[model samples]
Target chain A: MDVQTWTYLLVIVTFALYIGIAIWSRASSTKDFYVAGGGVSPLANGMATAADWMSAASFISMAGIIAFAGYDGSVYLMGWTGGYVLLALLLAPYLRKFGRFTVPDFIGERYYSKTARIVAVCCALLVSFTYVAGQMRGVGVVFSRFLEVDINTGVVIGMVIVLFYAVLGGMKGITYTQVAQYCVLIFAFMVPAIFISIQMTGNPVPQVGMGATLADGSGTYLLDKLDGLSTELGFAAYTDGTKNMMDVFCITLALMVGTAGLPHVIVRFFTVRRVRDARKSAGLALLFIAILYTTAPAVSVFAKTNLLKTVSGQPYAEMPAWFKNWEKTGLLVFEDKNGDGLIQYVSGPDNELIVDRDIMVLANPEIAALPAWVIALVAAGGLAAALSTAAGLLLVISSAISHDLIKNVLKPEITEKQELWLARGAATIAVVVAGYFGINPPDFVAAVVALAFGLAAASFFPAILLGIFYKRMNSKGAVSGMVVGISLMLFYMLKFKFGLFDGGKEAVDALEADWWWGISPEGFGTLAMVANFATALLVNALTPPPPEHIQNLVEDIRTPEGAPPAGSH
Target chain B: MQLPTEFCRLSGPARMFTFSGHTNPDNMDQPTRQEHATRYWNANLRIMAVLLAIWFAVSFGAGILLREWLDQFRIGGFGLGFWFAQQGSIYVFVLLIFVYVYLMNRLDAKFRFDR
Candidate 1:
């Protein structure tokens, strides 16, 4: 079938599956809404978490980043997956054992202060909001391209689908739908990778295909060839660790910690029954996520290799129809720089014949003359990824507002039904705000995602870990640490993100586009995390410890128990 | 790394508290609190060190440093180093979390410390 026909059928089928899942898993009680009654199987929760964790950015933008970053992009590969280790090891089970509905609950009660909870709430909202914006933008791009609809219409449709499932089902609906999405996205992601891998190296597995020798028995290593090709076309060495090593290290560290701290990912652990289950679920979740993450770079390499082969030396006007199609969307564009019809897709220090880097992955199958159905499947996959993450993030915000702020703090006596309405209302409002931001994403989706991670790292990560492992951490410490940490990272990011805090985006947009002190915005969170740790420590030392009951609760959460008999509650 | 085995000797809820119980008098004493805090911090530090070590070895050691040497070999068209940096490190990271989950479970059981 043609791409248009495929796009229509896939979107209809996908939407129907999602709505059906939502109806089947409609959440009634507050417990059902928030934690899915804390009864999700480890395997089920793993699937859901994988879907939640791998956002539109992962499916659509990561390959694009790697396509360009080349060897230096290892930071993304290491930093992103490496964060899950921190999550499963240091954060997940402990939080699960605590059995709270949200991250702010642990922070608020542990510190025994509303200020700490409020600080945490703000930080959570900020990270989640920024993240949701990226997802919305992803949805918009997919709709605009495949459906031939306006980008805003695509975003609204995605929001509606997510709202239908998320409002009725809450975590329960999102979880199951996400499982389906995980399958679609991973299948969508891997099929193309495998195809390209086979075409390039006679290998069906993408991971193997990435490092395999160049076709035509070129004798040089695949990376060496890429490096040669890149530099030859006036780009940096493909495999050199040429960045400011310190900044790269920091960014990677920040992302690892930030990922661990994200509330949506952490709350997934709570869906499992026991601490042991939580651990198992985390491991499984990572494995499922890895099915795609591991394949992303391979896809990047394959796509890059294909482009260099197909278009690098060819005349721009003679470029394939796919090129013109993507350019029409403005996702990819060329200006005949120096009046030359040849288009060079290299990173230049100053020249501005710009192409939106995200176009590489979105246009991969098309670039390779793959079947139109694959392109349609990609369109569907992008929508799934963005919508799933957006729903998950929206739920986090609404849950925080209703569960932590409204019920837990402001009115502890609120009924479950009332709280449920408030949560839904909060979720709906969050979607509207996110849609607005989606209309004008502050930057490329991946860059914005990195900034969200940085904020999350600075604010929540140290607090959550400390609450689990440190008895002395008080409210004063947590409040101060999160406030300072998030603000510091925000100041740095805002300076470079838009014309916001310091020099405008243009000042940083020049060829000297390195982040402050050479720390790319993606990696700056590590420095902020350290700052959070130190500040929390110092303030905790100065402040008094929480009440006796609070300490006892902390200790109680540390111990695991045998599973209680089912249906006993 | 070996932990302070005797750290869990205290009975009842004491095992739940990571450090000396909260310092509310009609509360656990300072010496006990200091001991537990020190022990808890040590265990957490040990775990972090181990995980961090593995992390660096995979990404920096295998991915960047030894990538050249490993690249002499190939899997399909991909060099071993390229695989590790792009794909292998992530696989190892997933394994690391499971390993950590396993190790910490044992530690918690031994210390009577996990919930």
Candidate 2:
């Protein structure tokens, strides 16, 4: 079959499966809507969490980013996966024992203050919206490539599809559908990787192929070859990085802390049956996520080798059809500098081509000359990744509004049905807003989405950690710390990223020599998070301790005994 | 760090205590329960501190801070530091999660908190 027909068929099949799950498991009450009735087994919840956590960035763009970024990309690989260790150890089980429907519920009850809940809700909405915007843009990229539709139309279709499942099924439907998505996405990711690995290194396993010698009877290892080629082209060796070590350290720390603090991911543990199950499911989720995370580095090495061999010093007119196809998308731009018809994929400031890292994964199958169906499967996988995460994020956004803002804060007297409708309305509005951002992305959507982790890291991680670990941490400390943390991060980002609030006409780049301790804006969140911890500690020391009952509540959550059964809420 | 003898002496009863709260209510009073809870919480904190230290040593230490020193060694076809940054550390992380799960479950059982 043709690539287009195969893509449509696979995408349609997956959408139908999602819709079926939604209809079959449509939520009947707030219990089902929020925590899948709290009956999801550890293994099943683990699979769903894997799907929810590995967004389009992980499935579609991470390898691509790694392919070009060389050793610096390890920050993402370690940072993203390492956070699960923190999640499993410190957060998931305790939060589950707290027995709340949403993150804000835990914050509000623990701090015994309405304002704390409002602050948490605001942070959750801010982080999830930033994240969902990237997912929407990811959907548009896949649809535009496969369905041959404009990116705007693709965003609308993605919005409509997400609105259907999220409005109808809530967390229950999304959970089960995400399990199916995990299978589709992991299969799609691994098949091409295996094929490319075998073609390059005579090893079917991409992980092994990453270190194995090339199949061309050369004794040199694949990485050595890549390192040589990169340096030959004026780029840093693929085995080493040009990034400042401290910046890499800071970015990795921010990403890991942010991952642990993300509301959508943390809430996934609430769906499992018991406190022990929450811990077990996190381990399982990490295992599932590691399947893709470990494979991504291997895929990165393979794609980088293939691209360097295919493009560098090659005549532009003789370039593969995939090159031209990606060129039209504006992700790959080539100009024959030096008036020669040859292409040069070099790394100096005057390089003739600007290749967006995102295209490396999307264009991988074609670059390797894979068959039509595999390419189609990649499209389906990308959509599954985007939709699963988008649905998960939208649920968090809606719950923050309906459960936190309206039900708890604004109208405690509202009926269950009214709350459900409000959740649906909030979700629909979120979808529309995310779609608008997808169509007109604020810069590259991925970079904007990376800010979500920074925001979550700076604002939520310290507050949540102190709430659980320190009995004396008051609402005053948490609220003030979050405000300060988020403000510092936002000020830095606005100044560095958007170039906003510059003193009346004198343009200043934050990356210049005056950059704080040589840390990029992307890495500044680590500093803000540290600031939050210090401020919260200082404030807690200065103020009166939390009341006796609240201290007892903290101790109660510390132990698993006398806990209410799941779904009791 | 405390000597092994001291560590073992301090942890013996905490490890051996298995009074089920429901089965033997009189044997475990509020004070005893609170004491056991404190010890268990302390033990949990100690275990977490050790594991997190190892976690930091592997990722930030070998992978970043001491990377240049570690790069003097190579495993298979990879620099030891690069391998840790990309592959070795992730494997260790997963192993740590499971290890934590196993130890925590045992701790809960010792305290009769396991369901």
Candidate 3:
């Protein structure tokens, strides 16, 4: 079949599967809707979480980032995956033990304070919304490429599809569909990697190909080739770090913690049967995730090397058909600013000419001269990754507003049906908003993905950890701490990101050199977290512990099955 | 972190050694809350230490501090230091999650604290 025919058939088949899952697994009650009846198998939950966790950034952007940043991009890989460890070991089992529906629910009950719950809710919405934006953008890219529609139209299509599937099946439907998505995306990622590895290094395995010796039997290494080319083009060594080291350290750490603290991810644990099951499921999830993470670097290296061989030193008129196509959208722009007739797409201030790093991954198969269909499969895979993560994030958004905010605060007596409806409606609304923001993403989509790590770290991790482990923590402490942590981190990020307060990139970039105590905004989250930790501690120490009634409730949550109830609490 | 000795003692299975109103029937007042606090705090601290070590090793150790020295070794087109700073480190990270979960399960069982 032709590429378009194959892509259309695949898209239809995938959609049919999603709708079938939604119809077959429609939620009938709050439990079915929220936590999939709390009986999802460990392997299945592992698959679903893998789908939900590997966002558009992971599929489309990570390889590009890795290819370009070289060694520095390790931060993305480690930071993103490391958070899972923190989640599985430090948070998931305990949160599952708490038997709560949302992170805010845990906060509310743990601190015995409604205000604290609401603060957690707001933070959840903020982080999830920012995350969903990237996913929406990914979805648009996929649709525009495969469905042959404008990006905005593609976003609308994705938004509608998500609203239909997510609203119908709730967590139950999403879980199964995510498993299917995992299969599709991983296959899509690996096929091209395997093909490229064989073509380049006489090896079928991508990981092996990544470390393979040069084909010419020269003493020079493959990475050495990349380093020489990039340096000659005025770019930093592909294997060197150039960003502010402190910021990189702080951001990477924050992302790791944030991954652990994200409520949407934590809630996946509740779908499992027992505490031990939660831990086991977390391991399974990582195993599924590692299949892709381990292969991404191989893809990055292969794609980058391919692009340079195809494009560099070629005259503008002789540029390949793919280059001409990409340049039309400015995604692969050719300045010819120096009237050089040749495209030089490198980092600024030195007139460098190299491919954009992100393009290295997204446009890899095509760059490698693979068949058109493999490229199309990649388009579909990227969409699946982005869409799954977007759906997960949007669920968190609606839950925070509808379930945590409206039901918990404004109308505590609202019927379960009404709350569920609100959650569904809130989810739909969030997708629409995300679709809009996605069209014109903020300047630093890459950095924003990273910033989410910072936000997740500073705001939620401390409160969630304290609530689960520090039983003496008071409501006042958790509330003030989250508010202060979230707001302070947001202000710092916005200052650098938007430059609304700083006026220009020049001013904000200057801050990297001239900031107080030499703390870059990315790393400033560590300080925000410290502030959160201190404020929570000071407030908890000053305030009275929960009333015996509340204390007893805490005890009840800690007891395993068959243990005596703590009474009235 | 010289917490009270009562914490170490409370590490075992439920027992009746009261220090409150009258340990008449159920050891209800024998400091379950205090014991929970100490155990939870200790477990969290332990997890923090291990995860932070892995995080630093991947990011700081591989990516920055030892990158130049380690770049002498090559795998495919990537140097040992370069790959660690990027690919190897990420693989280790995903592995770390599985290791942590495996370890935490045992820790929970040992502490008699699965709840």
Query: What clash count goes with each model?
Result: 16, 0, 5
Worst 10 residues of 3 chain A by lDDT: A560-569
Residue B79 deviation, candidate 3, in Å?
A: 3.7
Better of 2 and 3 by lDDT: 2
TM-score of each: 0.89, 0.95, 0.89
Per-prediction DockQ comes to: 0.38, 0.61, 0.40
List residue ranges in candidate 2 displaced over 4 A: A503-510, A566-569, B1-31
Each model's Cα RMSD:
5.1, 3.9, 4.7
How well is each residue in A369-431 modelled by candidate 2, as lDDT tens digits? 999999999999999999999999999999999999999999999999999888889988988
Q: Pick the candidate with the highest TM-score.
A: 2
lDDT for each residue of candidate 3 in A1-569, tens digit (9 for 90 to 100) = 76667777777777787778778988776667677778888999999999999988888888888887777777777677777777775687667777756788878878777777877887887788778888888888777766678998888888887888788877887888898899989999999999888877667988877777656667555666777888877778877877666666776777678788777788888888777777788888888887888888778877887777776766788977777766655577665666777756555754535455556665777767788778778877887898788877877787788877888799988988888788788877887888888888876775676677678788889988877667687788878888888888888887765565878655766555555466666667777888889998998899888677666665555533322211101
Shift in Å, residue A351, candidate 3: 3.5
* Reference-based lDDT, residue A197, model 1: 77
Order candidates by TM-score, high to low. Answer: 2, 1, 3
The candidate, 1 or 3, that scores higher on lDDT is 1
TM-score of candidate 2 on Cα atoms, chains taken together: 0.95
